[model samples]
Target: MEQTKEISALLQLIDDPDEEVFGAVSEKIVEYGKPIIPNLEDLWENTPNETIQSRIELIIHKLQFTDLAEDFRQWNVAGHFDLMVGSLLVAKFQYPDLSTAPVLHEIEKLRRNVWLELNNYLTPLEQIRIITGIIYGYYGLKGTEVSYTNINDFLLNKVLETKRGNQLSNGILYLIICDLLDIPVKAISIPKQFVLAFQKPGYSTEEADFASKIEFYIEPASGQVFSHKDIESYFKRISVPALPSYFKPLSNKKIIQYLLEELANCFDNDKEHYKKEELLKLANMLD
Candidate 1:
């Protein structure tokens, strides 16, 4: 096939990922090697559609990546976090087809709250302290044993004890804040680590976050990494113990379902079930 023809076909497969396309492109990139990268660059320059151009750049970057790959070992609970995230996204969020904007708005609100509480002067320990406090305040449910203590120990426990998939530690906070704040952040799924990038809200143009171009990273579920105390408090309302295995990002779309199911789960008693559903529905409308 001609080079331009191959590039056009490759562009079509960028956002798409099926066996035939992914395998063909992956094999071809490996075959053509780095020399074909300039063609990708040239195509990007000529592409008028900004989204397509950016996607082209990402394809180039991925093709060029020579990072180490993981063994996909399941020795511990660390790597299974994505499973929790996927499950929550599927089962908890009511599988909503909602816009990503509101979630981003929530992130902004959360960030401003954190900025108010800790300002920019917080040490790592202090930041953890404040985070734990907020998690407890917002998410603490009943009958749970998770604590808001040992904030730092739990945060770094995985990396400290296990592998160093990614070097940056505070990245979780950055992406969460960006999502909450309504920034144009997108996730890049990479082997062993998920990463994030940011852009302006309007599509077809770009204003990359923190002045960094082509931000890369791991995907974070909205509410994961809630400090121990926060996790405790979050589940405390429901009377369940901490199940790190179960926590994932919460969504407005699913919050109602969670609130309802939780009511059912907690109120086995007849009197509370009927009364709670009526009142909860009323309040949800307000929210």
Candidate 2:
């Protein structure tokens, strides 16, 4: 609900466009600088209605914008995070190809079928785990060419059916699964490896998991489970450069750091990455 005075004042301000009022507001905002924020904030909280409080809060936030200088500049310099994040999301679809068994879309359809099968057997979380397995099963198949369409019957029926190891690409496919499933699955990126994290709403409240190490999720295409040693080896392979002091066991903090790196990779600055669509996909996996 809106407060009458705030709406009336807002309408008057909109209609009149009083330079005096604007000047006064701007001047006071400039004068007290950051110090005035608290009082304005107090007024905002004291406001009786939601709309009025929101308006007042926006004003206060603007008044306090100077403090955001570093953040804003960083956002601008990063080439804007949104484009980066968007690119990253799309980039994962690029994978090494094997035999020309099928086009990308057909494989996608088969993958989706297997995923639907996996979904049938387990709880949401368990579904995610098995689907992750099913995705890896597609690896080293007759097809690697990626597209929005295409299917390899042999790979779908034979390759995955035969292979036992779950690959990391399953996690990549998990992203799409998440998109479809509406689960709270987050992919954390490491220099060489990746860790996937998932959180979900439960009957109680919230639950989070970061137990699966990068190794637990292997890339059969590469044929190795990622490990701390693997990260060092990857850096060494890239020659970015030298060996580090120590390799640590996987931790949730590392998951968060990796997640941020992913955001950094994706360039999701100044955007609402959280949305119903993303959440639903995650929910399917995380639940």
Candidate 3:
């Protein structure tokens, strides 16, 4: 934005010792939206004091977050929510300046590799075998146990860059690729696990006979396939009932919402509590 005298005065008062005054200044600055981000960045560069620099950083983050929240709102209302785009938005929460081109390119490369091995004659299991082989075997995408301490594991871009992610992120990446390929895989509502289900032909999530819809269950973290018996054994071991709702396929929006809620947990510390709040707010928008 062209630096008006009012904006200049607000920038100058960013270092004000009074918290109430600074708060007022921040609200006014944020009202200018993202257009004023470059000016804030310039001010951050020239600022000397670490404390004041932190203040400027907070204001800048607020501006970016306000914009991001709007993006999430729009994603929710869109006729069809693209999983790749939704995941990238979560990545943008932490990496405000993230370049999506690299991420998209890498995903496209993986998609092409998988596509080469796929043919119309292949069975559903065969299709999954090919995808799992390319992604986990050839590409070496590793799935680690979920850890809130490792924030990158929850981000799609970082997951792709490092080739390692927890179950949720790896599962999400798996879903995104499947979506691009027009596969029938979906994330299910199984408790304590991020599992995918390969739906049978001529059946959808809304159909009756929940058990009949799924060809099999897949553990995305390891690309391990599970039979109905295996899933039954799991429920018995966990002492949880095998409820039909647990087998229902989760919508793409719900999957992203789960990601945001889990990502929010990584920011529970005193210094990052605001991040937790913002992430939860974004998650609620998906609801």
For each candidate in turn, the TM-score is 0.22, 0.28, 0.98
Tens-place lDDT per residue, model 1, 54-133, is 66654554444321001111211233333222222222122123344543454455567655676556544455445434
Model 1 score (lDDT): 0.39
Root-mean-square deviation of every model: 21.2, 17.1, 1.0
Which runs of model 2 end up more than 4 angstroms from their true locations? 11-131, 135-233, 240-246, 257-287
Flag the better candidate by lDDT, 1 or 2: 2
Model 3: lDDT to the true structure:
0.93
The clash count of every prediction, one per candidate, is 24, 32, 0
TM-score of predicted structure 1: 0.22
Q: Write the residue-wise lDDT of candidate 3 on 1-287 in tens digits.
A: 89999999999999889999999999999999999999999998998899998998999999999999999999999848888999999999999999999999999999999998899999999999999999999999999999999999999999999999999999999998898899899999888998999989887666656777899988888898889999999999999999988888888898999999999999999999999999999999887
Poorest 10 consecutive residues of model 2 by lDDT? 147-156
Clashes of 3: 0
Best of the two (1, 3) by lDDT: 3
